[model samples]
Target: MLVRRFKKSLLVLSIAASATVAHAESFNRIASFGVIHNLPEGTEQSQETSPEIIAASEDGNTLVYSDSPFEALGFVDISDAKNPVAGGIVKLDGEPTSVAIGGKTVFTAVNTSKSYTQPSGYLMALGLQERDELVRCDLGGQPDSVAVSKDGRYVAVAIENERDEDLNDGEMPQLPAGWVTIVPVENGQLQCDKMTKVDMTGLAEIGATDPEPEFVDFNSRNEIVVTLQENNYLAIIDAASGKLVNHFSAGSVELQGIDTKKDKMLDFTDSQTRLREPDSVKWLDDNRFVIANEGDMNGGARGFTIFHKDGRMLFESGASFEHQVILAGHYPEKRSGKKGSEPEGVAIGQFDGETYIFILSERASVIGVYRDTGDAPEFVQLLPSGMAPESAVVIPQRNLLVSANEKDLIEDKGPRAHVMLYSLTDAPAAYPQIISTRTSEGTPIGWGALSGLTADPAKPGMLYAVNDSFYANQPTIFTIDANQTPAKITAATLVLRDGKTAKKLDLEGIAADGQGGFWLASEGKTSKEIPHAIHHVNSTGEIDRTIDFPKALLANEKKYGAEGITLIGDTLWIAIQRPWKDDPADQVKLLAYNLKTNSWGAVRYPLESAATGWVGLSEIVSHGDQVYIIERDNQLGESAVVKRLYSVSQDQLKPAAIGSDLPLVKKVLVHDFMPDLKSLNGYVQDKIEGFTVDAAGNGFAITDNDGVDDSSGETLFFSIGKM
Candidate 1:
């Protein structure tokens, strides 16, 4: 009896011990896939093998990892977390530059191997279910990356040659040269067909250089795409024949140390070339795509890049980015902080009568307010969100506040991801903690944390994002809806996918259009430096169009990024974050395409030098007879938010042309103070994002703390008496 009693006690203790250990293990938050892409420095095209992550799947089902630092393949089964199990390891002959996955299919892009003697690898396809080798197609020279067709019928592989040690940086590669291999997935048919070499060297010869090739993707018919790179440019290509259609240049970067590794967050630079790190690309409909870039501006500033599928230089603006994160201590020369301040994630949404843009600032734990009337959106600051607000958005009818907590964008502090939901009670503007992705049942899936977010009424649902990786990589996208209660997720999608074409998205930015489409922007910062693009997936998950911006405009604009893409009435407006020398005055264009005119015009916002008391353009809106613009401090951080109003006469854009300086409406004031900031983000936190006019003819705008750190953030509303 004594022995039995002792055994029972011991057994109980053992069970309790085991339970304690299990509880001690931290629950993996949302996986953050590095949002930015980093490549080897200089002209030497070497991709990191292990130290980086490409993309991650939703549901935390799978992960597509690369060891460009070691040039190998790593697969992890994220299904049973608490601790993700390493699925298996595959040794590649060369560097696996990019990877994508869908369902059970995995596609990987292998570049020049470190072994040197081994034949340059092309692309490998593997089936995750059977652990079977689907196919390993070889290629000549070195391939940049691969893209699969929507139906999984074709794979578009962008290939290039190794830099000749003896040749100068400007000289072209003569060996295998540059080409996109369109191979049939079933039998690898491209091997037998006469090899087709499309001359993408046009952008190169003209100075787009070291091109980062990209595709907006194709469905059943011929898919059109845009390619970008330094000295090269944004080019429209015929997917079938590898034929050059049309394109525009982003600019040039001379022979220098252009490191693709140190890049942390999105900034002012080209996506394809060197200005920005080109990590991912998404098609925003069929005509345009948003490219997320991560890199140090090679003499240019850093940010995201936008391009037309037909290779037109869309427009780049500093006002577009959700936010930028530079390492706390590491910065290029004197360009560390935003005018000396740090910024975080940018949240935007629509609510109430007036358009309100709320900004969440780190440290200070406050929210920035940008109020928009008929004129431009004004700026102000308020206390909302939590201690550290990562990202925020506003629900249409229900005036509630939602926020993503990303500890800190630059420091890599605290937990990976956290979120706070708040509401505007009859009391005052105070935010309380609501939902969290880190709970045992919650899935933060934020690779780095939370980066950018926007809402589309078309889905009638809500979406939240974690900066999954790139900036830190492992990022994830979590979605919520109006019907959902706090802490509840209606639907969600992983950040990574099995790319059918040559596009492996490192999800960075999000834009939703009223027309039933959600836009996802990616940052690709590897060898090509291709500009970022905006991808629009319909209700059924089919991409319609993508607007590819020229790589030249990307590099020259300082960064080729379309941080924020929106529809102001029928016209499409894009914001390019960084312009050339971080000088907003250098012509960060606000390109407007008038659906009625069937033409496009540039509205230049001299951002860097726009301190003339005039509001520099960003977080733009068109309300009936008046044009609303928000000038969030791009260079000076957020010391002052100058929300200036401009009137665009319906008659001015008609037969005649009313370009940049149309007319200032001093009387028609929108937001008066620097409304887009939380106290912590300092002057840099006020980045106004979402804006719109509702049925009441009242304008609604939402702002967020640029994901600088994670406190709490908020979404405010204002009343725009009438249109």
Candidate 2:
């Protein structure tokens, strides 16, 4: 077993600056957003910006972030190298998410929101001091990625704006006006002052929602290449005049979250998701570029593709890249395990000059690990775990690998995921095996525990995991013996409203109190679909005989998707992944539960990034004053290989006990092993499902998936800190 350990926060690996970028700097590292999930009762999480981040910043040095408007840029100053201080953030008329720095000036690709028009151009020239302001120029609606000219004379903006949001009646908005705009900048300001916009209204006949012109960039000769979100043709525009040159399409990339073969905790719709329209087109060196074809545009992020500047194919993401499965049978034998095939999530890691990918395949019930060599990915093998595997992460800084698992029964997949760990070592086989534990249901209890696993901050041999066993089939809680051999017996017991198994009850999220206790939360079972709520069950793993969560969040399934739970300082944070149709502005609904006052405050925010399938918010964890939330795709439960990791401010979940002296939970992904890894090159992979953080700030995750044979149970182990 290869020991997978969760790394500590601040462990960032810098990407050596490349001279090929011509006007290139470096990738942003640490991005410590100053917001908190600790919203008050009857409120939502505090969020300031909405421009979703096109890329997450790592390395804790430079910041590659997308601000509220939808533009991506880099920040130079970071605090503690690990604890990044929002040193400098920039934005313009367009939202900032993806940015490329040339020389000292940063070219940002931004797009306006639905209620507006006219995507704009943003240019920034960093002075010797690194202080800069944004110079905005009109680009067009919903621009694609941006590229710079080697001659430093022009900046190309890809415009694929097909207004599809406002259907007037019910028609999908398709901005047939696909065009490329060339705006010249001298001294960091628009020199042309006049943007040369190319016209592409022809695609409107195809009926793609706003399938406008996209992929604007200059070739080696300074000629521009543009592609649309819809259609196969790449439209070429005259770089100098911004005139339409030619149109053609090679193939397409598939956009997805993680590999399904590795993860087994999420809800899937059909057998699986297919590739959809592509987004995020980047030029790979001058001739080749990479495009992420978001299959499930609704945040499904399936896979990606590489293309040549002349509309030729380089490579596309493939499930069959380097995978070799044992072949349960003629067609995968439908893994038969106690835990049904409830797909977990997936994870991607960059280490040892290679990309380590993992997934949780609950049905086959194995944790899969793989490696992608940039050209193609290859399958490694399948590890064992408890029942179902959910979510996992790999943080190299701390040299740790953690997974969260839960126990439950649904459909044929068998039981829910479980909590497991593996200590990452210098060697490959150091991966830890699953520590078998007996569930509270000892009647030869078929499956294992539902998961919301997290490492403890205060104790050495302890961990807190959650389950939905206690409620009317609702989620519940559990505690594991961290020091026991193979993680010892479940010795697991968690309190849920009177400690009775009520039908239709919901208990999913769990976090450590930093002292010897734990925090447990539950969603409303079935009563009028009471809004999801948070509960601060003590460390004894018992439910609080005192407070009520429903009253605290005033949660309603209709408005907010308050499904996931976590704790950051004194605040108990709840995640609302689904926004209410009536209230589109509600980006994040986080209820800051004050541990001291034991009260709830409201801090709501909107998001520019995408979301999961929006079933039940899965789990929440805090690492280094930052809060992380886990969301599932949908009910079908098709575990993808990787999971989505987002960061929130410690101020949001202000753990009431911290006095300016102590630190909030600080944990990060060091290693992630799960199911369904073949998608990423690993065979025997399982889905990683849940996540947890203990009092000591260490991290742990639970993962599960259908087994390849369809009759086996596999779980793996992963840990956070020294304990």
Candidate 3:
């Protein structure tokens, strides 16, 4: 009887532990609102637009954001929440720097500066219910940030007499020093005549004469905390007295294990001495405040810091936040030489009796969520945002968080500036579809641009993936465990040639050889001096041998060369990406190389005709007597049409000699990938570069992030089930 009871208790404990682990809190992206949609009907949709800073109405059903490029303030009606409607835009007389909402009243700081030395701006109030401007007051200098007190008694403005970067390389002390403005507000009405300017000079260690106040926030005690970003200073002012209470240098930090080069690799062994030139500041509580250290001229600590009101240091992130970005595959290798990950915006709010902090990385386009523990904040999770999320607003009452993204890539024909919405709930997180675990030495197995995938024949959920030319100096193949909820990369192998890391190899396809080696397809570019070749690499990633195409095939090769490879017995099949010079219109070649005969042959595959863009094959995989290939168009977002999987029978894959007439193969559409791409509610990504079937016959697909170079860096790795 005692033994039975003990076993029963152990079973109960195990079940309870599983339930507790499954009930953790999470935030998942719910909707995305493009700022371009807020434009008036007569305006061109292609015009550059941005949502730099944002605020929400009292009821949390409406949002207001500042768009500096169009010199206007935009609004979004989130009454439906998941499906936001355009609430139109309001044209302002000057550039709207920042916005805040008190009850139903909207307040904006407009920068009307004629020059850096001759600075000017105004504080304007507008009634949201009336949809008109209520009052305007001339602020002493150009304003950058605006905040309202918790008691709704007053408003604080950071008048940043900004400096011109072209003049003297933007070294400060350009005169017309900046200061803080305090104005009384009674029942949603601003009393501008009672406004007072608080001088903040002779304080900072650098540029003490010119204090450029960058951001401001009000504490529960009606005190304001402001950040002098360019001056590397933080100041506190009493709202009632308009007198400076305390000030301190934002300080510097010694960073270890950081990537500080734009050398096409994600190596985190370097170090740097960085200044915490914070861009955004927020009060976590009455005693502690947090800052997003986004450096300008000299320093960016690449993380965040927490400090007490009495100038006591509480906590410093110290490259930890940026390291999380690396684990999520959102590290911007291109910005390694500058401020890595560039934490530019911060927001503090309470939910379910717990205070949470949100830090936005402008370059990496991700948000780090943390819980305020009074001492060192506890990291919760990472959220994917739109390009360059400049500001965030949290509506805890409605369990919603919004981000204002400021990047508009109209010229590059990429995703436009957007306002993304996320909701905290019991649902699982939809982001970080793929992540890498830390190595034994505490370094991340850094990876991105996963171009191809092939499953291990014997392992149930194990698969291998390869990187493209994005990491030119670090060609790698990653081993992934797909049984995990969000598939985790377990290990990495460097592709080596002659015992050295391979260079200039654009690996686009992988196929497991009958032996313990693999066949890799290189998508070559003549302009860049990369060759289109089939390389056989052993299990340890050593190049055992290579095969180049014959003269008949090479004579008509284009930049879009071999994309995918598959092995069937002694024959190897390669999928040509597009129609080469020698192929018929709207047809690509399935070039075959026979290892037993040492000869090359080809067969044509019909391409899907797209209405807006050209369609081509991305991958080829052989299972049983059938071969599956991915065919997609180059378009992205709503313009995408043809991302699908097609299959062909092996009996019809007979290939002729490369110099002779080629036979066309018939293909049947197996699956349309559009629904999978739209599952997360984000804009559809352009590169659906990888597809494979695990040993269990479950199909999987992944998209490339381009190493977060002008990209959102959201890798969608998910299972499609048995194919």
Candidate 4:
């Protein structure tokens, strides 16, 4: 199977033709703006904040986004589009739900409702140049979305008198029912006196008397399209007269090849029936528009749909979009029980005489780009978004795209909520740097959390990687074709013990045995009863032996145990993650087990000290007369400092018997991986867990994604060229 997969990958490479185009257009992320930076001077840094919806000024110099947690509208200056600056925030009396730009003014919908039963909201128009409120009008109910007409003569707001989920399983019919509010504007100046309340009652089949509108958008003809998300309905209204033009059920869809359980693994074989609840709607033209089906009540189709203004369905994405997300390794397995990928928000923009549709996956944290062909949209590429992307806005004039992500991990001390900016330039795509190809059975390789890496001794550019314990139920080794663009995982082999799949083993390191097998390092935490051990497995992935830590070493063991392993002739050297008991400060033991003698010995290695956090070893590999190791700090984002690769001479590895005074090994700095990690234009990730030198002397590194659990689920795999 390995030979067959390798030959197939080579065939693909052989048949592909390279073209040298002088101009290549692609979107590349240039800057990321954290929402916490826009907080007032006195505000606490730990306060949670998020940017849910975003809009940009006419000249594409200013960005405004709604921050519900901070009860304000955060601003960013993008005059230098490559570098964005915090422009402060505007505190409001209520939670801002959405924002839109109209010439020199910004319109925001603020929800001030005290309870679900008695709802109230307000629409405020703020001057863009002065950053001050120009006018405010009572919107009768809590608003969910806001939009401005292209001509800058009208503003539309979707009043969603949302029900409390704690009340009766969150079934609809909770009153002070919702409606659409249309107001007149002249030269970007708000005219609140001309507001008209358009009743949206009896428009949806479910909860007909209490319509909860979710999103609103205006077409070139001044016609407004609204989505009643919870009720599974879409309605069109003539803004000039505030009268309903047409309405229809958003409609159900049948999906196959989907995983519908939270099973800690990716298996797209399940099927779903009749799911329609659409959330955000955007106009494609005067007669067509698209709706993102992010279910609220009983359905989430996991895709988007296009429809004509006269209630005609033009196209339904069904499971197509989510399939691409699955292939990209961005599918959120934890969200399988609810909505897979959850297509929530969408933005359509015309650039370079072509229309592009951007769909946001709230759970997967990716954006699917599609070109409008006037039929089924053409899939272009997928862009990596921050965690929980809720909305997006495009600035075609400046060739820019922005996403507003709403997940702030202040309590968890993880990466904060960010607004990512991408520029459309004449360059190649930079994301999805590593992905898996489909197997012969037409299923994705389904690999993630790549913790350890090692190259095949005979096959150049061919590597093997292991997944960490995040997929506890499925420990597997993957075969990668590193020579391919973006690198491809070609096959997966399940690690087995006693004829059954291995469990409770946090396999973090891999090294090829001289006899067509491998030695794997397992990290241990005594509290969980998982011991630090080494397993010897055959080429077919069947475990032949398991070696436990020496009793003397176990007596001084700590939670941070073995992280990496490598073979040097008849000896297996393992990297201990951090300083264990009985060890000196800023030093860790490199334990060695003899394959033939069955004896244990050790040597101490000095670790770089970190100013804010502890530094530790993540991976190790034996190449030439040296052992290369990855040492990094457990800090994320801008706080990360010590992600470096170092090498120690084999001659200095003078190991002493267990329980004896081990000699310290001197190391040489090989490279600092900070610049490579930041090349994607995102906050630096902390887990640089894998490193290996291939048979051709090329070096490669990979990061662990923690199985996309409480993470954006981005796996970085790149080559550091020659060692």
How many pairs of residues collide in each model? Answer: 210, 255, 0, 0
lDDT of 3 at 269: 89
TM-score of every candidate relative to the true structure: 0.37, 0.43, 0.95, 0.95
Candidate 1 per-residue lDDT, tens place, 2-120, comes to 00000011111000100011111111122221211222235132222232323344333555555554465555554543234545556666676555554456677777544322336
Residues 1-723, candidate 4, lDDT per residue (tens digit)?
000000011111110011111236878789888888898998899989989999999899999999998999999999997788999999999999999999888999999988888888899999888888899988878888999999998999998888777778877788878889999998777778899889989877799988988899999999999988888899999988999999988878878778898987778888987557888899999999999988877899998888888887887777878877777778888888988888998999999999999999988888888878887777777888888889999999999999998988878878899999999988887878888877686655677788999999988899999998888778899998999767888888899999999877989999998677999999987789888899989999999999999889999988998899999988999999999998998899999998899999999999998999799999999999999999999998888999999999999887899789989999999999999989998878899999999989999999988776677888889999998
| Displacement of the residue 45 alpha carbon in candidate 3, Å | 1.5
User: Best candidate per lDDT, number?
Assistant: 3
Instruction: State how far residue 30 of model 2 sits from its true place (Å).
Output: 7.9
Error of 1 at 645 (Å): 51
Ranking by lDDT: 3, 4, 2, 1
Candidate 3 Cα deviation (angstroms), residue 312: 0.8
Query: Distance (Å) between predicted and true CA of 84, model 1?
Result: 3.8
Candidate 2 residues 1-723, lDDT tens each?
000000111222221111011111111111112211111234332223222222222332333334431232324333243333434444344455334444456566655545425433343333313545556565535555566675666787666554534356324453345566687766655564667766666543344345555444455667766655554345556677766655545343332222243222221111333432444344445565554442212222233445555655556543221111121110122221111232223445555455555555433344555555444434443444433343343444543333433222333433322223333334333222333232333211112334456666666556655544322332334446656433533444535456663333355556666666666555554445643555555655455633455432342345334455666656677655555432344244555666688665544444433343333345566667566665433332233333434455666443332111212333344343333222221223333456655555655555443323332333434554422
Per-residue C-alpha lDDT of model 3 across residues 499-595, encoded as one tens digit per residue: 9999769999998875667899999887898988999999899998989878889899888988889898889999999999988879999999999
Q: Which ten residues in a row have the lowest lDDT in candidate 3?
A: 1-10
In Å, residue 367's CA in model 1 sits off its true spot by 19
